[model samples]
Target: MKGNDHLITAKAPGKLYIAGEYAVVETGYPSIIVALDQFVTVEISRSKSFGSIVSKQYREDSVFWRRQGDQMILDNRDNTFNYIISAIRLTEEYAQTLGRRMAVYDLRVNSDLDSPNGKKYGLGSSAAVTVATVKALCEFYQIPLTKSKLFKLSAIAHLDVQGNGSLGDVAASVYGGWIAYQSFDRNWLMAAHRQQSLTELVDQPWPNLTITQLTPPENLRLIIGWTGSPASTSHLVDKVAISKSRQHETYNQFLIDSKRCLNDLIDGFKNGSLSTIQAGIQKNREILKRLADFSKVQIETPTLKKMCDIAVAHSAAAKSSGAGGGDCGIVVIDKNQNIKSLIKRWEENGITRLSLRVHPVIDLAKETK
Candidate 1:
């Protein structure tokens, strides 16, 4: 794709939240997120035809295409196709503003995330696709969109697809680091603050960490367990927002406790305090239970609770990582524990487990071209 001067390619990966899920929607709370090894890739090439952007999807050796300016169409078959259109439309608008000639292009998008049985692992695959598509368009059209700007643009695209959403997921996918996100009211005051301060916040360098010097921990494992049911994070978040607007004391208390748990986890990671980290996970689970009604009927299921109980029985600290309902759970194992044996035990119980180890946060804008 690179050999063709007119074509451009870019890729961005999905992400998992290390901490701060529902709490991030609050004004003062901060969220921590990291990009996963899994990614979605986009390739864009010039088309000789004018005013005709053609979009394609590639999955499992199958390919399909859709034409631009047609009725707003969404292929129920391909999730990545929706985001490709968003990226192209955003890129085209920006190009128009710069007085650049608009040329039709062919876009090819591929995703590594699995979609079997209509099940998703809640790993931010949609955000990854949006970021990758935007990056490809920025490169292909020679439009200068900074990482933060790209993140903001991708958030708009996300809202177009999902109705309403926090940009934290897209920010994590693009920036690839521990991010502290605060959802400000989209009022003039908050918008002004965002416009004035976002760049500075993103530009600030990550703190130095001693973990980079040590060999990645062999026993440190993350087990992502899926609950077959799916829940809408946007709806849950909006409900919570409405509850907050009504000044519900119970909801406000949950937010406070969530923030406290998140801060403790961040501090634990900083000091390498495994005990504190485990304690924070435990507290976070408790807070989730207290706020059960916010999530409607999607509280952690009996099966997931039993799994967490088993992990705890084995001395492993576990908690739900994303919007609670039935998405996924993250378990952090101790350094001295045998992760393989633990995973085997999980599999015996019909729980799927994936190994994930934490790494130093990478600043993508500075680290990559």
Candidate 2:
């Protein structure tokens, strides 16, 4: 193989959920996710020798990276960029283990998400950056990293940064389509007995269905409302774990119902059945209410709930996308509805609205330079 010395850049978009959140973390649940137009970009150029991966951002100053080895490195100065470095190191190691030469390149990353702009919309900026890094590295090294492998590797990097993370975000980033994910015991994370238990679950394949992207009717609209408060998703997940440990039946039931509702929503999406979608969204909201009361308590801020109420009043299906404690909400507008009027009302109430057109699953390999 000829070693090509060239610069390659790649971008990966952020995502939002149509259904399933907490349930997606538990086993036997399906979650639906769509890639948003917002994205993160990585620029990779050949270098004389491996030194450090330098990173720069709008809100932060230039930060130099650290080297771990020809395979791995650590950059603790910036928590946000550390995961990107970690993914690059791991990908390099994987390539070497297979008797391939790893590319030595310098990378520059930039994100256009609203997180740093004081908006802090929870749109998986971290996962998007990780996806971009992995894509860029694969291109530079000429490594054939499959989408599934990319999802698994990115999930590991996410856990490294957030302690524990659901695969939903990374799956959405790498696959660029709707996905349903559940946490099963992997040998890497499981103890002897737990590993055995996970084997039983792993024996059965995870059930996932990708939603078909539909052409939006002229009146259909998507409104993204910012709640004006930053959410700590990791903290909320930990809280749920603790609550489940106490054998809270109500919380457990919410998780179960969430799984069911998510499946229904997936079916609705696949069949283009809006009625089923509407019903599933309503059921999902009910389950979220129960979970919010039991597990997160203050998970939904007053402003967010009010926004949901407004959308419901307008015959729209709406809910908070992620570990909801005041982040962003997704509203599905009816084709016969007045989208402009709804946007006007939201803006008048200080909520930011964004228009998005859904498309088919993105081809991640095509994104490689």
Candidate 3:
């Protein structure tokens, strides 16, 4: 696909949160995210007339759009393609600034992040698809972009549609592997986007945003267990935001505690201390539980709790992964730990252990045309 200049293809890996779920939504808060093996792939090819967007995940539905000046007017009423449309609009806007000509193209997406039954696994598919769409469009338009520019463009597109998220998933998708991420100020970006050019915004430093790749301890093993339920990350984040507005002091403390916990977890990775890493996971779980209790939100469901308990019984540290209302739980244990018993227990309790590995970093330098 890289050698094919006529067709542009891009794959963005899904992500799972290791720590700092709710707190990471706030500006300047840090989180740890890992890019998963599963991905959402986007492929773009030139079209004769109007462009159509189709996805394998949504077999029956497709979106037809034609450019009117700079805006893409969707011909259909279905809103499932909003993220893709947003990505295209933003990417083309950036491309136009480079004096590139826009051409009609057919875009198709195939995702492996969901279950065969169309059940979402809470693996950040939306973010992955958005990043993939942006990357594909950039390539199709012959716009050279660094990984950072790609991330910013993708994040901007996602925020335009979703309006809420930490975009840690976007960072993980862009820079794959394990990453320690600090969220940028969306408020600042929104304001800047209105006043500044798209190219200028991508080139400028986004305040409070920082991404650093981290090398996990060689002995550390990551396990993901699904609760067979789907979670709405945006809805959960909105609920937490409302809760934060009501309980100012408590939310502030949570932000501080999450930062400290993430720092310790990153240090664990740096020092190769499996014990410290496990301890950090445990602490983060406790903090999330407390936040759930006070916010009156179900961050961790009963099934997730059972899964975590089962992992602990097997001497592993476990916690709910994303905006967990019951989707997936992550376990961090030493490589030497026997996980067979844990898997068996999870299976007995209706938890499905997912077979996924961390995706390695992508070389963005090669993306240049």
What TM-scores do the predictions have?
Answer: 0.78, 0.85, 0.97
TM-score rank order: 3, 2, 1
Candidate 2, residue 278: Cα displacement in angstroms equals: 1.3
Per-residue error for 367 in candidate 1, Å, reads 7.7
Q: Model 2 off-target regions past 4 Å? A: 1-4, 58-61, 65-79, 115-118, 182-220
Index of the highest-lDDT prediction: 3
For model 1 the local lDDT of residue 252 reads: 78
Query: Candidate 3 residues 128-229, lDDT tens each?
Result: 999999988888887787899999999999999999998999999999999999999999999999999998999999999999999998999999999999
lDDT of 2 at 55: 55
Model 2 per-residue lDDT tens digits across residues 52-96: 455556435344443445544444455556677667755665556
What is candidate 2's TM-score against the reference? 0.85
Distance from true location, Cα of 335 in model 2, Å:
2.8
Cα RMSD to the true fold for all candidates: 5.7, 4.2, 1.5
In terms of TM-score, which candidate is stronger, 2 or 3?
3
Ranking by lDDT: 3, 2, 1
Instruction: For each of the candidates, give the backbone clash count.
Output: 0, 2, 0
Tens digits of per-residue lDDT, candidate 1, 302-366, equal 65786677788888888776676666677777867766666666677767775443434545454
